[model samples]
Structure formats: structure tokens, C-alpha cells
Target: MRLLLCFLLLLATTLPARAEVAGEMAAALREQGLTGAVWALVTPEGVATGAAGLADAGTGAAMRPDHRVQMGSVTKTVLATGVLRLVTLGHLSLDQPLADILPTVAIDNPWAATHPLRLRHLLDHTSGLDDARLWQVFSRRPVADTPLMQGIARDGQALRLRWPPGQRFSYSNTGYTLLGMVVEAVTGERYEAWLDRAFLTPLGMRDSTFGFVTQTGPGADPRLAMGHFDDGSTQAAIPWFTRPAGQFTTSAADMARLAQFLMGDGMIDGVPFIASDLLRTMGRQTGTAAARAGLPIGYALGLQIRDRHGVVGLCHSGNIVGYRAMLCLYPDQGKAFFISVNADSETASYPALDAILIRALSLPPVTPLPTAADPERAKWQGIYTPLPNRFDQFAYLDGLTATVMVMAVPDGLLLTNMQRPDRMLLPLGNGLFRQQDRTIASHVFMEDADGVSFSDGGQSYQRVPAWRFWLGWLSVGAGLLGLGWLLLIGLWRLVLGPRSLGGMVSISALLALMLPAPFLIWGQSFLALGDATVGSVLLAVVTGLLPIALLATLFLDRRRTGLLPWLDRLASLATLQWLTVLAVAGLLPFRLWG
Candidate 1:
């Protein structure tokens, strides 16, 4: 009888808001080049849903309420809730050391003895694991969580923690993936199955599903929504084995129920899935990353805690390849909203829709920025990055961009990126600096060797000697000049004529060898790096000639005169210098053979 009632409720369009917002959002999504999207708003009274656009933009097929979209990292909320439920039952503990819980999975903590990874760290995105990597988990076919977990253990020995556990937040999908394995270990059931039994059934969510999903052809699974590209082409969903990190798919109505259950006591049909106490713990601030940095943002379990005037809003957003999702909860008002789009468009209408609904229906409007001046703000000026020694080769550029420069303005402090000087950050600050935007970014300064190190939320950066940047700029100059000189010589030979084919062979061969390199990097992200293609073969050839490329140039042009000699010298010098940079950046040393 209960199941029947829930099923009917899931299908029945309860309120008029469905047709209204659906039309509004669908029209808006089309303007943004999105094929389709669904939005669900929940209140203490009940749930209302709206959707618009098409499931298949190419085929012009209208989207239905039943269409499922990928949740991406939004899967974390469900996974964390499951883990917390176990904690409520005394089967798990939030503070329990992860190394102790999953003794079989190999995770090395350089701060092992003192600051080991705790269960809460996994939920809060602070398990010290490397954030994300672009690699596929298949050869013949997609595998199970156990084997993938084992690979994380085996290959992850070299991947160090980005920061000490609980020191701050650095969003890590690897940590969540390991947590999925922990669920398998604890309940003796796969993540997908356990989630069904725990939250889905009780909360009356029937359409949601998980695990690696693959489609051989377009519209292979019509029940599942295809991710639409900006060009109106659809991408068949691939098998994503990182189930815990992502791989969740659900309907908007079901997602709203999940959001409602999160802000509540976790009770359904007068039974508590997890105790009210534990549910409260999920909302309580675990780390002081935001508070200490004077940011309004706070993270509790898998949820990002935000501020609206004085009301607290628990939220999370997910974006992977083709889909985007945002879920916001206003506990004070007992209201929440979930918005997701099938197409990845920059001009998506969800953000504007969110603000409109959040203001008129949910929480009070946010407080406006104050006009106050601080003269002593000069004390906070410095360059800062993600704490000390957190940079690894795998995420070198990400680490470099984390660097921020603090400049004192007449009214307040301005934060700027050294790598992107054009960008400016106007932050709110009284004593500690904070962002006035929807995000909870905070900036704090601490004592350093030369000056103060600036910490933005979880990432810390220290002021380095200006010469370091000057050296990098010089390297860039040498690389560009050399490449241009060779290009000019190539054009001259093609049209004006080369004295010998020898000059053309060496220069062109060298260029051809390195041609596949950038493609390898792009393929690693777009496709799979290990996927053997013609480009991969050329990349291997480049790596084989890594040391000998410069040597051959010296031999070929050693006796030459005029521009040929300098061109060879400069191009070879640039190649060597660029190779050195890549090596230092950890972008080098990929599989060069087979």
C-alpha cells in the first residue's frame, strides 16, 4: 500500500509550478544551447517540479520527468549520508582512522602517525588524496570496484596527499572513490545496491541508479538522458568506473526528496534511516577552513554550508563533461531546490533561476557589501599558494594557478593571480578577508620566511622571489623565438628552396616527432591516454628521441653558416629547455613505447 502511494506521487504532477517553471526553464535552456533540464523546488508544504527542452536535441524528442541525468560529484552527498547512517548504527565512526577501517587498501600518509585520514575527511573532501586524474578503467570491459580500488592502492603509492588531513579542504574525488570501497567492506554489498536499500527505497526514489553505464549507439537508453553538446550533438555516456567519485543518475523529483530528507531528521514513514543526531552532525562544521580564513563558507560532511543573511543554506554542485547539477538547501526555511541540465552550456539559466526562487520563496536577500576603508591593509600584501610542499608533478599547473597576490586598495584588499594578472578579486574583509560572492572563499595571512603566506580557504601560497617568475618568462621567450625561427626557415625552404633536403629532413622530422605530444595530453583528457592510436605511436617516437633530438641538431648544423647554424642551435636549445620544463612540471615521462 505504501509503495503504491509513493509511486503515484512520483508520477503525479502535484502543483501548477511544474508546467510554469518547466516552460520557463526549457525556453531558457534552449537559449543557452542546452537540450533539456529539470528543476525541483521543495518546501515544508510539499514538492514542486519543472522541466523543459528536449532529451534528444538532434532528434527533437521532448524530455520527460522520468529522464535520468548524471549527478557527477553530487553523488558524494548520497555516499556520505550512507556512511553517516552506518555511524548512527555504531557500525562506523566519523572520527575513525581510514587506514584502520580499510587496512587492505594501500594509502600512505606522510603525516601517518600524527594526522591520519579520518572518515569525516573523506566526506569533507580532505583525505589528502590527489584530487582527480584522467585515466580510463577498462581494456576489454569495465571492471568492478574491488579491482579499481586495488589499482588505486597499487598505482597510488606514488600519488602523495595534497595537504594534511583536516588541515583544509581540497576537493578530492579519489577520497570518495576509496570511501565507496569502504562501503563494500562494511556492508558486504556494492555501492549501488546499498544506496538503493538505504535511501532510495525509503525516500521513495525509484528511478535513480548508479555504476558504470555505457551506450554503443545514440539513444541506446532513452530512459537515460543523453548529454547534449553545444553543437546539438549527443555524446553516448561512457562506462565511468569511479562510481563513488561520480556516476550517479536520477530524476529531479527524486533528487528533491533526497534534498528534503537531508535537511530533516532522516525519518520516513515514522522510521529514522539515520538518527537525527547523526544527521545534525552532517550539517555541523567539521573543519575551520572557512571560519579561520574569515569566509562565510562552511563544509559539513558532503554538503557545502552557505549563508543567506543569517539563514544557513547547505548545498553542492556537480559538473562532469556534458551535464551540470546544483542542489541548495535552506534548513531555516525547511526548503531546498535541485537544478540540472543535460547540456554543458556556460549561459545556462539555472543560476539566474536559482537566485530568483531563492530570494522570493526561500531565504531573505543576502546583505550588501559595506563601504569601509582600512589604511593598514598594506600589511596583508604578499604572494601565497597552497600550503608548503603540496605541489606534485601530476597537478603542477593547478598548483601554479593557486598562487594569489594581495594588493591593498583604499577601501579594502584586492587579491590577484600572478599567472593571470588581468583578473582581480574584490573580497570582503573586516579582520579576515572573505569573498562576497556565492562561494565561500576566504583569504588569511600568516607569518612566513620572507613575509606573510596568504591562505585562500584551504590553499596556502608563500611569497617567492620575483626572479622565479622572470626565469619562467625567459624560458617561454626562448621557446617561442626558437619555434618561430624554425617555422620561418621551413616556409623559406618550401617556397624559396633549401640548399639540401638534409636541413628539411632534420627540422621537419623533429617537428613531426613532437607533433603527437600535445595531442597525447588532449587525448588523455578527451579520450584515454593509454588508448593505442597512431598519435600514441608518434608520441612514443618523440620520447625515444627525447635525449637525441638536440644531439642530432648539433651534428647536422655544426659546420653550417649564417641563419642555418643559429636556427639549429636555437631550435635545439629551445627543445632541450622545453623538455626540461615539462620534466619539472611532471607532464613528461609517459609510456614512450608500445
Candidate 2:
């Protein structure tokens, strides 16, 4: 009788704890105005799954724990696992050069003879390849049946290396797409089919799929959650060219299984699926300058070492058009959590939920242990500018805005930028540095053949002389002032004097330069610029004619004599100088579409 009473008391307490957690999850969805959400929590005891809100907001169908949602780039973790499986089976090697594997693919690497592009480099995002271009990501054309090589060939420029492979880290969807091609070449089968049979099935994720799933398809499940925008409008799934990079649909229950596998010792059903050492390598970075300098935190293979609320975890986040998801595994604590929301609302409080979940799991906070400051920190102090942006099209704008100044302070080093709040980095010996409240080393300074450089894993920056930095900003300021002066003078002259040939040509040039401004300001979407639409074509034409019109004005109005004319001449000169800088930066005649 006493034992029965104890068991009844335990059940009573557990049920309400679960109910309280469910209430918190529902309130989180309501606060964000989200259509639906699914989540899973994995602890040493067991896995718990929950759902909140509507699966189909229009149909009023309630979301179920089994309903599948797009996992986006979290697919990379599965792809990397499969690659590691192939390595263990002796079918592939991580250090194998891409030139040996795919001889026909056009990979332009200047340092290929020495530092070859290897499989591990692609997996770790140190391949030096650019991310997908605009058309590659936003194309409306159907790619469901397109061959991997054919899709890659459409944007061949993305394959060119910006630097030597294995030198640094830069995220590249193109690189992973190439890895999918490698899987096809080595296994003699479609990547989707192979991964489905070898990976998803073995892990007991029976409800998950490796390819695109559409609404009301022959094989589509009615339980598939509808993706939503901030206004609760539904969005249909579109076929992506880079399927292997980010195109898996999975349920919360299935994600729990995957999370369990990540937290386990590489065994499935008491059989060794992959070696424990190999699994450990999946979360560690190697062969990069930062890694060589004893900085171990970065994008390792597919997982990112993230510090959330002073607790370090192996984490990955994914986002498609209207769906967003995050997975975090704290292996040391035997705890993991996965959360997905149907709506891509910026106001969604992901961090709030993360904190709540952490507290619920009783995960311990990481203690900060600051080491002595590096005596050689003075060489690392200066203004540094970002290099080799992930997208070449945005390089010019990023160059102007992403510069950071590193200063040696009494405690450690200070990182200051105009665009973001200041960060204080504590020394961690051997040129590694981390924030005061974080456990992982988040910054590193290194010297190479090119020069001294600093990296935060994803982006790298090079030190520049102070004069060059000031001169670049000065040129930009002068150009803007000159353009404004010319616009005001041209309008005043038109109102005051007869419209002469010189006046008209000068005005035309000024207007030609400023025509793209409205499109930039009032443009509906950046995705529209990816294709050959009417607006994109107009932008391309105007930018192409900018230099020619400016040169013509300079020649046609050279002989005009007056204060306004001379000032116009000077303004035009300054504009021309700025245009020259743009030309050197390869942004002239800016064409958004292929």
C-alpha cells in the first residue's frame, strides 16, 4: 500500500511539469504570431516531443508531433555523416583531391599544385569557393530532374577559388553541392536515393525524406506542416538547385532520433555504425590557420561550435523561405534540443526559448578561465578590412562597411566597429582570444605569406595602413558631396538659363548616375534581382551606361566657362574618380542576373 502511494505521487508531479513545459512552448508561439511549431528534447532519461498551434492555418488542422517540416541546411549534418560513413568503409578519403575525383569539373585553383582542394576542405567550408550566386538561389525554373553537373555548370563562376584551399573558412553552398556530385560519381547512384537507403533508414527516421516534398503530391503526407510568412500566409516548397545542401523534410520525432545519434557513441542497435573517433572528428576543425593556432571552435564539417548563454554546444541552424529551425547538442551534459517554427518571423524569441529549455534541462554554465595576455599583441593591433566575401556581388558594399579596429587594452584586446557594439576579447594564449563570458576561442590572429590576418572563422580580415583606410572613406565622402552639388546646380541652371547642349548632357549624366537609387530604395525584393526581370534588366543597362555618360559629359562641357561650370567640372571629376574605384573593385556595369 505504501509503494502504490509513492508511485501515484510521482505520476502526479511529473504530469504537471510536462504540462507547464507545454504551456510555455504554446505561449512562445503565440507571442511570435507563428502558425505552428514542433520541438524535441533529448536527455539521458528519454526523448520528449511536443507540438503547438495549427499545421494548416487555413484548414484549422492542429499540428501533430509527427508532422514533418523542412530542416533547411541542417541537411548538411546528415550529408556529412554519410560522407564520413563512406570514409570509414574505404569508399572515399577526406584528403582526396577534387581534381582526382571530378576531373571534368571546372575548378580554378591557382594553388592546386601544392594545396589541392580536398574533400575535407569542402566539408569544413574552407574550399575558398564562393557561395551560390543570385540566379543559383532564386531561379524560378524547375530543377527537380536536373543533373548535378548541369545545375553546377549553369553558374560556373561560383566554383572558382578566391584563395588557396584549407587556408581559411568561408561558408559555401556551392561547395556542398559539389560534394553531392562527388557522392554521385563515387557511388554510381543519385545522392537522394543513396542517402535514403543508407542513412535515414538505418537511423529509424522512417518519416523523413531526402528530396523536395510538395503539397498534395502523390507521395506527400497530409501531416506535412504548412510553411508560413510573418502574416500567416502559406508558402509552397520550391525546387532548389542545391538539394543536398539544404533540402530535407523531417518530423520532430525523427529529429529526436538524429539528436540521440549525435549524442551517442556512434552505435546503432548495439552495432557500430561509425567509429567513435570519426564521430568526434565531425565536431572538430583542422587544417586551418585558426585550428593550427590552437583555436578549436568553428564550423567543423557541418556542425558549428556555438556559445549560447555561456554554455557551449554543437549547433546548426537552418532557414528556407518561410521555415526556420535550430538544433543544439550538449554532448558533455547528455542533453540536446531541436526547435522548428513554420513562420519565418524576425520577432520570434528563439533565445528566450533556448534559455527556458536550458533551465529546464539543468545544463551547467561554462566557466571563463582567462589566460595571461600575449606579449606579441601589439603586432595584431590596427584597422582590418574583410577579404574574399562569400558573395562577390556584395564585396564592394561589405568592404566599405565591415572594417574593424583591434586595440590592445589593459585587460585584453578590444574589437570596435561602427556597425556593431564593441566586444572585449580575453587572451587564450598562442594568439587565440575569446569573449569574457564564453568558453570557446572566437577569434585568432595569424601571419601568412600574404600578410598578418585575423579571422572569426567565417570571415577573415587583413590589416591595412591607416592612410589607405582614411583615403577610401574620404573618396566616398567627396563623391557623395560632389553628386549632391551637381544635382542642385543642374536644376538651378535649368530654371535660370536656356537648356543648352552642355547643360542637358551634364544633367543627363548626373541623372544616369542616380537612376539606380530608387530601385535600390523601393525595390520589392533582392531575389527579383537574381533573374532577368524587367527591373533587373533596367538596372543592368543603367549601370552599364554610367561610365560612358560620365566620360561624355566631361568632354562635351570641358570648354564651358563659369563658377557653376567649373564646379560642375570638379564634381564630375570626383564622380569619375569614384567610378574608377568601383571599376577596380569589379563592380562596374553591375549585372544582377547571369
TM-score of each candidate structure, all chains considered together: 0.85, 0.92
Q: Residue 525, candidate 2: how far off, in angstroms?
A: 6.0
Q: How far is candidate 2 from the true structure (C-alpha RMSD, Å)?
A: 2.8
TM-score of 1: 0.85
For candidate 1, write residues 1-594 as lDDT tens digits.
999998788667444445556656756665666778777788887877766787777678777766778767788887888788788778888889987778866666788888888888888766667665534332212453445464353445544675678866667777787888788788888877887787577778877766555444643556777786667777766655465777787888899888888888778788767888767765455464445545545566878765433345787778766788878888778898887778776655557655534643546655545534555668777655554433343454544565666677755676776555433334455545545442333455555344566554445566665566556657767866776676677667767875444456545655665688677666454435444555666776665565465566567667778866676677868866866786676565444221
Q: For residue 546, what is the lDDT in candidate 1? A: 53
Which residue pairs show backbone clashes in model 1?
A: 384-461, 385-460, 385-461, 386-460, 387-460
| lDDT digits (tens) for residues 392-460 of candidate 2 | 667777667878899998778999987668999888887888877677788889887888888886688
Alpha-carbon local distance difference test for all models: 0.66, 0.79
Candidate 2 Cα outliers beyond 4 Å, as residue runs: 1-13, 30-35, 54-62, 153-158, 216-221, 346-349, 371-376, 494-498, 509-526
| Global Cα lDDT for candidate 1 | 0.66
